[model samples]
Target: MSAVLLDHHRLQYLHEAVRLGSVRAAAEALDINASVVSRQIALLEKELGLSLIERLSRGIRATEAGALLVERFRKWEADQADTVAKLRELQGLKRGHVDIVLGEGFVSDLMSGPLGRFWLRHPDLTMAFDLAGTNEVVNAVAEDRYHIGLVFNPSADPRIRVATASRQPLCAILPPGHALAGLNRPLRLHELVDHPLGLMHPSYGTRQILAMAEAAERIALAPKLTTSSINVLRHFVKSGLGLTLLPAFSIAADLADGSLAAIPIDNRLLSSSEACVITRRGRELPHAAGQLLRFLSGQMRAFRAGEPAAKMKPRATRR
Candidate 1:
């Protein structure tokens, strides 16, 4: 008997259908008709001689066999990309793509210097960045959807490997004239309670660290506003609506321009928070991604050692 062969196109259709939860959704994503997606998956199921999907009223789900196949296909796609990258390396081509997912907080530091300098060094290479919360960043990296993850105080995950980490404590951010801005020393968590507070949503790593500190110190924080956008939190404080806690690197430019002030928090857990560069465990990155990772490890302010608050002295109050 001849060896069995599975069509790559059929497998891709099945993978997208299961991933997107509907043939129509997959068709939209793949820019094809829903019937094409259905037909391709049907052919895949027939060729494999197994039930691949369970069609439901709401959407579709992969069967056990389908799930296994999808997993294998994902790994195979990652490997194929890696192989192409290696081939480019062998050809001494200084060109490839790197995909990175990171917390919104790191955007400033990344774009400030590292991104520009790296692009100058490798003009042919392309890069993409997706902004996500810490959990999303970790999951995207671990699932091989992204090549690198930049996060703060990431939870320990066996599937992730930290390339480098630097001490980046959480700091209370205040508008230039806020009462807390006058404090030359670390601010106590309790000091923030009476003031209006804006906070990142709980999905943010900064919020996670703050939650632990709140629990440890037995303090309850009630923020008037909760949002997922770092910009919103920054703007909330800058507009003097309220203060928020964040890593100094997140708003380095604001701190430097004296539009905002960052005061250290006098909590151990908050102080212990770190900025980390993470990648999937046991996976060799493409050459371009690996190079970009190393560049970020050395150049990004988040991964650099030093207290950002030291340079962020509160702007002297005017009478």
Candidate 2:
């Protein structure tokens, strides 16, 4: 074989030509001109000392040797694709899709704060958001069904990697015209139970927060409305459905708009109820995900310190 015959460009042209069925089609698929593809294929055929493709009246067909070459090159191309995929997964800055399984509360409040900002930092990493419950998040991450998971006090997975993304005190979200719209100070948990409360569905992070509140109070309190959607919950609260408790950031817009008020719950119960970040243990986070995690860690310091939300690291060779 000639030194010039074994080039990647030539081999790539041949493979694409066979796969695409014609020189013009291959060039179109490869975003190159037909002449360039034809020239490269000619060079490749000359190097192999055989015609790989036959120009038929309509289009083209591969010869016997060409068919074999296609088979071999197809495997090589598949391997090349696998190599590219794995490399992209490693760099954490590759053009790959990420499926993020987080709770509805998280997608409502925290994602826009830290995670949204991280999207601007890394544009190549596209994220698909799935609003899941604590149980769902825990199960998906433990089973490697999702790339990253943001959840609450679910049992830890030995096979999962955990990080504390953000720690915000659960605050009360009251609809307009409610008696406790804006109190002078944070209301006590018992005081909160006095009114019919809106809570998330069972097994959700919000429900966990409610359970903790109930456990602290040592009583079972039924919710006025139970749901798995933050938007629906917010709408219910806004439409005078009932007062629900959520992270302060989650109700920021409603708070600002006078439709809802955030009654601070940074008490002992709130301190114990944390949205622990969880993922598959050994997997590396993408660039945006890592940056977002860093921002969450920093911003959440204020929460642990009992201060208000103010602002918005790596395990391996992450970029």
TM-score of each: 0.88, 0.60
Instruction: State each model's CA lDDT, in order.
Output: 0.87, 0.66
What does candidate 1 score on TM? 0.88
Taking the tens digit of each residue's C-alpha lDDT, what string does model 1 give over 1-319? 2355978888899889998899999999999999999998998777778899999999999999999998778778888999999998999988899999999999999898889999999999988889999998998888789989999899999989999999887888888787776668678889999999999888889989899989988989999999999899999998878899888899999988888888877777887889999998978998899999999999888988674543565322211
**Candidate 1 backbone overlaps, count:** 0
Best by TM-score: 1
How well is each residue in 1-319 modelled by candidate 2, as lDDT tens digits? Answer: 5554267777778777876688999899889999998998787788888898999886688899777776566445544544665687687645665567877665545544566565566667676788788888887766555666777656555867777644566777776456665345556667776677777787776677668667876877677777777787788777765777776555555655666667665357664556677766655655445655566656533224344542200001111
> What number of clashing residue pairs does each candidate have, in the order they appear?
0, 1
Model 1 spans > 4 angstroms off: 1-4, 42-51, 309-319
Distance from true position, residue 154, model 2, in Å? Answer: 3.4
